[model samples]
Target: MAHETSETTAASSVDAAASSGRRFLRNKVPEVTVSFWIIKVLCTTVGKTAADLLGEKAGHGLTGVSVLMSVLLAVVLVVQFRTTAYRAGVYWSAVALISVVGTLISDSLTDGMGVPLETSATVFAIMLAAVYVVWYRRERTLSIHSIDTTGRESFYWLAVLLTISLSSATGDLVSERMDFGYWLSAVLFALLIAAIALAHFALDLDAVWSFWIAYVLTRPLGASFGDYLSQPTDDGGLGLGTVVTSVLFLGVVLGLVVYPAVTRKDVTQLHQAARQAA
Candidate 1:
């Protein structure tokens, strides 16, 4: 009887450790809500303005800017992926850098190589759709709620990269080719995002679908907003310049990251609730 009890206790300890590890892996993605949207928009906006400032204002040119940002993004992503747990600062910094690189990719093709925005948009959309289809087929779930595994994180980043590229192409197409102007494009995207939000909250759309639709739209919305703030006064902007716009958004994002990191209040509460439900 004594021997049997000792074995049972040992087994229980092992099981507990395994369960804890599993839970840690599963909660990688941040919860989708107002704060998440706000930070995401700020990151994308910073991405657009910062990339322009580096490339045009700094005279690094498109290739130099693209290469520099791409290297930085890769380094950030390495740190982010290697992190055993989510660090808000690392994660958001990676996101901001990725946003800049994605925009650079599209811009290089469109402005440097003279590829049409319409063509780039179509190709990026197709690529993003393919990523989603494959991710779903393999994982059997597209829930951001369950991004704990390496495979899910891979899919998540791939989707994000493609969405950024597509959004850039589409935004440029509307603003430049269609001559809608920055302010008008921003208004149009804002309305579209509002419609998506309404559909999600009021009309009972699936959470995954609603989240993704909103995510894709936010990219263009951020791009348009950045353009509206940073473009020349003659171009209907506030004449703030890209440097000022980038700095403003970066400051906001830094504050958001720091708050979450220091408090850990949000993280603790979320995990506690998840434990209770489980």
Candidate 2:
């Protein structure tokens, strides 16, 4: 009887471990908050500055930079898709790379192919709208909270790519064509984002609408701030250079990712509470 009980207990433990692993893998989305937004903006700023530094300052040229970044983004995205759980470093690296690639796509269309900003902006907007319509039609919901399924994840990333591309073209058009300058453009987008937030919290806008609006606005806000810091004084910027801006933002993102990795305090606490209740 003692031997049989020991074997059964061991089997039960193994089964429990497997179950726990499966649950962990299924929790795909991160806990959204202020920290998430702050890091996202930092990544966007790095994306703009790093892409420009590589193409213009480092002599990589537009085609070379676009090709290289596009390949890199694809590799990172593959890694992200393969992972069963949310690894902050892998996920955020993919985001940063995609941001750069998205900006490059818009820049190449405008500078290399001579496509008008208005046209690029409109094309991206239509693409994004189509993505949402299809995503909703299939998934029946647009909540970030439930990104565990493969189809939802695909839609989420597609929308993200479109938003970045559209924002890049629109930001450039407003700052350059309208002569609003980088700082003013940043302020304008910030206020627009703030209003969206107000509408979500105070006026009870749909959660999906609030999330998408905020996501789109962050791109322009990040781009404007990036240009304000990196462009020359004659262009109404601080002339900090792309390398410095990239380094600063990259360092912050690395630190934030590392903190969550090492501590794992957030994950641990949540799991512990779940176990206690169970």
Candidate 3:
């Protein structure tokens, strides 16, 4: 009886380990790293500049650009959802496109619909909060590390969409409506992100909350930075034009994402057998 029980327990352990490994493999997001943040900031910057390029510079008008980008974002999101694991190319592509689409959503509220940036920011904040409430209630956790199911992934993307919109509105409110200008606004957001990082490392802030806060702040910081570089000198920018700024940032993001994809360096690692045994 002891011998039989031992064999059964070993089989159970093996099965649990395999199940844990499968769960890890199914996670749809990359492991957070320094490269992740760099690529994210660049993606946000490209989001701002590329939206401007299409809407104003390309003569597509805001409505046209919004529609076009929304469709593209939807397509990319479908691909993202279908993937069983995180593919750097697909994941970052979705992020970049969503950034543009999110910017367009905010701009549409402000410019097309005559909504004040303050009002848009407030609404988006409420919506983001609601998403969190629902997500946590359903999943019992908001950690990105647990994004291994379609339902969790849905919540994650919805939260991301709101964050992007909220960030755009907040950035515009500070930089344009409040007369802070682009560069100064970038500095302010950068400082805020740094403070969050400090709190996480030194003050023992919750890791998940720290990550989300930094994620939200990066959107505005990158947007302000992009605007500062692309807007004309008279508008407190270097006058590089949106085209130049978008292309430059996109190139950097592509290179960074490609390296990780090739090397799998940023792939989340899990000691599945140990975890399962525990």
Identify the candidate with maximal TM-score.
3
Q: After superposition, how far is residue 182 of candidate 2 from its true place, in Å?
A: 0.3
Error of 1 at 187 (Å): 1.2
Model 3: per-residue lDDT, tens digit, 211-272? 99999999999999999999999999999999999999999998999898888776654322
Stronger candidate by TM-score (2 vs 3): 3
In the order shown, the candidates' Cα RMSDs to the true structure are 8.0, 8.8, 7.0
lDDT winner:
3
What is the TM-score (0 to 1) of candidate 1? 0.87
lDDT of 1 by residue, 1-278 (tens): 00111334434534564677744443455655567788888899998898788878768788888998889988988887787556788888888998999999999999899999989999999999999999999998777655667888889888999999999999889887899999999899889888977876678776678788888888888989999999998987888999889999899999987886686633423333445444
Q: How accurate locally, in lDDT, is each candidate?
A: 0.80, 0.80, 0.86
TM-score of 2: 0.86
Clashes of each: 1, 0, 0
Clashing pairs in 1: 25-148
Candidate 1 deviant stretches above 4 angstroms = 1-26, 265-278
Candidate 2 structure quality by residue, lDDT tens digits, 6-65: 334434544565667744224344555666777888889998998888888657788888
lDDT of 3 at 28: 79
Off by over 4 Å in 3: 1-25, 271-278
Give all TM-scores, in the order shown.
Answer: 0.87, 0.86, 0.89
